[model samples]
Target: MPTPSKISVVTERGQVSIPAQLRKELSLEKGQQLLWEKTGEHEIRVTVLPERKPRGAMAMLGFAKRFRQTRRTEDWMAELREGEK
Candidate 1:
């Protein structure tokens, strides 16, 4: 198969819209991220990073789901106080 190439002009705000055909071919989306790297004096590499889900307050979801807690937070503090004696 042949590679498709095209030219685009950067807007006044330094933003360039990805060509519609390339976007569709690459499955690019509105909120997706693209990493730009300069490989040479005039060459810039565009890398498509994997999609990420922002966890926010639920960052610990599915983490340590099976870990058993041996003691409560208060119980641990009490043990530390006694060990100082």
Candidate 2:
């Protein structure tokens, strides 16, 4: 995949405007949170993350629990051993 060459956003009252092309490509929507990092002089990185749902971590734990409940421990152990080869 080709990375975007250059992008610019206007700074207003200490807030920056994210470009529409980058926003759409990253699936960003209004009121979404973004993470920013400074790499070096005149360089910065921005990334868009999916919106987090309430109790999302609990839901993931539940998924793991249900999956483990349906699997035999011995079978899982065997698979793990095979993966070590």
Candidate with best lDDT: 1
| Candidate 2: 10-residue stretch with minimal lDDT | 60-69
lDDT of 2: 0.76
Q: What is the per-residue lDDT of model 2 for residues 1-85, given as tens digits with 9 covering 90 to 100?
A: 8657655665666678776777777778788988899999988887776788768566565575655557688999999999999
In candidate 2, how many clashes are counted? Answer: 0
Model 2 bad stretches (over 4 Å): 56-85
Clashes of each: 0, 0
Candidate 1, which segments miss by more than 4 Å at Cα?
A: 55-85
- Quantify how close model 1 is to the true structure by its C-alpha RMSD in Å: 9.3
Reference-based TM-score of each model: 0.61, 0.52
Which of the numbered candidates is closest to the native, going by highest TM-score?
A: 1
Predicted structure 2, TM vs. truth: 0.52
Question: How does model 1 score by TM-score?
Answer: 0.61
